[model samples]
Target: VRDVSEGEACPTESGFIADQDRETIVKSSMLPHDSAPRVTSPAADEGSMQHNISELTALCTSLQRKYSELQAKFQAQEEEIVKLKDRVKVLEDREGVAAKQSRDDAPIKGGVSMQGRQLLKESVMTQRRLQGF
Candidate 1:
């Protein structure tokens, strides 16, 4: 083992740090399992990664289902809005027709009673005499 002083360049070999440090730090040639018992095994790491992937996939699936449900609900609400708009239009058209029919059924001014027209003519003649016309 060689001593690695501060600011000193440690020896290296083809993509591997040579055994220079006194501490048993992991090297390229040494597998993680071959290190001290504190090191995590490659299989354990692989299993953990797989577990994380599975959890993510499940979360994605759940989110997708929720999105689909919300989309369907949104579509249904849109359809309901359209139906309500159509109903409003129909009601408005019916109101318009009722208003027109009421106007048509009501008496015209020319169809006033003879007594009512005579009173209007007398009033107009009195107003003309007062104005000397």
Candidate 2:
């Protein structure tokens, strides 16, 4: 392993530098002459990866909790809809029963009966005729 100087190109064991390696070399060469290339140890890289993993895990947990809350709310709304539907059904049944009862008691109600309605109509016609229409 000979010491490679600045501006000198070195071939790897594969006899070619990869595009990423070439890019890194170009970037390092573009820095100021007084500044050395920054290097990180393998341990530092591992620590950074661990930190990212922990943050991702926390974000995933938060999203899961939010999803669970939304799902519960949806279920509660569905239950409320079912209860409202049942109430509407009960009201419709009561209205049907009331309508049937009203029909059955029509004659007993007197003024609402067909005969009473005809008499009222005749009385109105008589009054209108007396008043010259």
Candidate 3:
């Protein structure tokens, strides 16, 4: 057998090369297997891919259910806060009315007290003037 490097030449049959030109053979002839090995079936791979997709879909569905529950709770809390705000507004209005009523009553009571003191002073002044004359 003739000695050859890996890419230098074909594994030639001696009689054929001498009979023909150099270009007739190629490097593909040197490979060990004539054809590729068939291992994975398309049907089995498709089933596995479908199973993974189904599991992901179920997980997403569960998350959506949890999100809806949280959304409902948030809505309820928001409504409760609004009700509390309205109650606070009513209480503040009542307090404002009570303060104004106290202010109005104070003026009326002060006026009456002033009038009573003025009448007492007039009576004392008239009695003193008569006693002097």
**What TM-score, computed on C-alpha atoms, does each candidate reach?**
0.52, 0.53, 0.51
Worst 10 residues of 2 by lDDT: 8-17
Could you list the CA RMSD of all candidates, in the order they appear? 12.4, 13.6, 18.1
- Please provide, for model 1 over 5-25, each residue's C-alpha lDDT reduced to its tens digit, 9 standing for 90 to 100: 666566568325334542355
lDDT of 3 at 15: 56
Report the lDDT tens digits of candidate 2 across residue range 1-133.
5457765657666545477688899999988795678899999999999999999999999999999999999999999999999999999999999999878757655538666787889999999999998
Count the clashes in each prediction. 0, 0, 0
Return the candidate ranking by lDDT, descending: 2, 1, 3
Candidate 1 clash pair list? none
How would you encode candidate 3's per-residue C-alpha lDDT over 19-106 as one tens digit per residue?
5654444444565674777678999999999999999999999999999999999999999999999999999999999988766655
- Candidate 3 error regions (>4 Å): 1-39, 108-133
- CA lDDT of every candidate: 0.81, 0.88, 0.80
